[model samples]
Each structure stands twice: as C-alpha cells, then as structure tokens.
Target: MAKSPIVFAMANPNPEIRPEQCDGLAAVMATGRSDYPNQINNVLAFPGIFRGALDAHATDITEGMKLAAAIAIAESVSDADLKPEFVVPSVFDRTIVERVAPAVAAAAIKDGVIRKR
Candidate 1:
C-alpha cells in the first residue's frame, strides 16, 4: 500500500471521507458532492442514455447500451487532460449528452435492440 489508493466516498450530501480530509493520501478521490473535484453524480448519466435510446428507437435498455454510455462518459475526458482530480466531466459539461447519445444509440443498433417497426 505504498502508492496512493483510489477512494470513492460517494454518499449523498456528505461523503464518508471528504476530499480535503484524505488530501494527498488517495491517488483518486471521488464523492457525490458536486463541489468536489471528482463527483460521481447520476446527473452525468441517465439523460444521455435515454436520449440515445430514443434516438435509436430502441425497444429495450440493454446492458450493451449502458456500457456504451459509460464508455462515452469516460472517453469525454482526454488522456492528456486526465488526472486524479478530474476523472470525470462536470454534469453540466454539455458535451456529455452529445457524446453519450450517439454512442448509446450506436450500441443499441449493434445490440439489435432497436424498434422493429
């Protein structure tokens, strides 16, 4: 345990370990609070997933589609810009929906879960 550990104290409003409390101890620290650097907010997900399903005229929300949405979100951040403090984009990043929608829609199409009609 020499290297810094990854910690996710994702609790509503109050995380188990606030970022400042852990400070340099954790390599990557995330919480449910928006004020923190790496906030694991659900807002960053659902909307785009729904939009993509609708756009693709999907009949069901498949696991493939969910994975696609997650990948899209992670891909939103460039490797060069990636850091412990900025693992994910903000909920209001605007491009999240833009990127996620297409990716999810594509996944639906690939999964053959689209509307038959």
Candidate 2:
C-alpha cells in the first residue's frame, strides 16, 4: 500500500482537501489558508527574492536564482526540527530574509545575471 504522501492542496479561499479529512492518510498537508497548521504562503519567498534581486542589481530572475532561493528556504528548517506539520518555516521567522536574500544574491552573481554586486 502506498504510504501517506505529502499533500499541498493550496487553493485560495478553498483548499482541495481540508487537513482534517486527510486524518491518518496524509503524512503532511499544507494549504493556502492561514487557519491550517502548515500554511504555504508566498510571502515566505517573495520578500527575500526581491531583496536579493535589488541587492545584486539583477537584470532578471533566473532559474539558478530561483533554485538557490528554494534551497535557502529548505535549509531554514533544520532536520531535527522538520516535521510533517512544519515542513516550511513560519512566515514570521525573522531569519528567513537573512538566509534567503544572501543565497539568492549569491546565485544571481554566480549565474552572471547581476548587473552589479
């Protein structure tokens, strides 16, 4: 039998499936709504992404920059702290901007997309 799969049914105003319905079937669940435990919000990334772009004077956001931002976000959650209900860091986590911005900026510089460092 397939084990519980991580589900991210992030539909605005209404998620495809409520966290409660998953019960024991889902290993982890996320939604666009803040009422849920794991709320997958775009705010987590955009701030840092823009900050990095501005800091690096990026010409345009590239795939490498996006990947670096993703990696930074993933690294924000330590292995010991990772859990089904805590796959993503809190939206209010102060360190997110600190971590993601530099990572994205560095990636932009590395990918030769930055107009100025």
Error of 2 at 78 (Å): 1.0
Tell me the tens digit of each residue's lDDT in model 1 across 1-117.
347999999888788778887887899999999788888888998999999999999999999999999999999999998999999899989999999999999999999999888
What TM-score does each of the candidates earn? 0.92, 0.94
Q: List the residue pairs that clash in candidate 1.
A: none
**How many steric overlaps are in each model, in order?**
0, 0
lDDT of each: 0.92, 0.90
Top TM-score hit: 2
lDDT by residue (1-117, candidate 2, tens digit) is 158888999888989888888989999988988888888898999999999989999999999988998999999999999999899899999899999999999998999988842
Q: In angstroms, how far off is 68's CA in candidate 1?
A: 0.4
Query: Where in model 1 is the C-alpha error above 4 Å?
Result: none
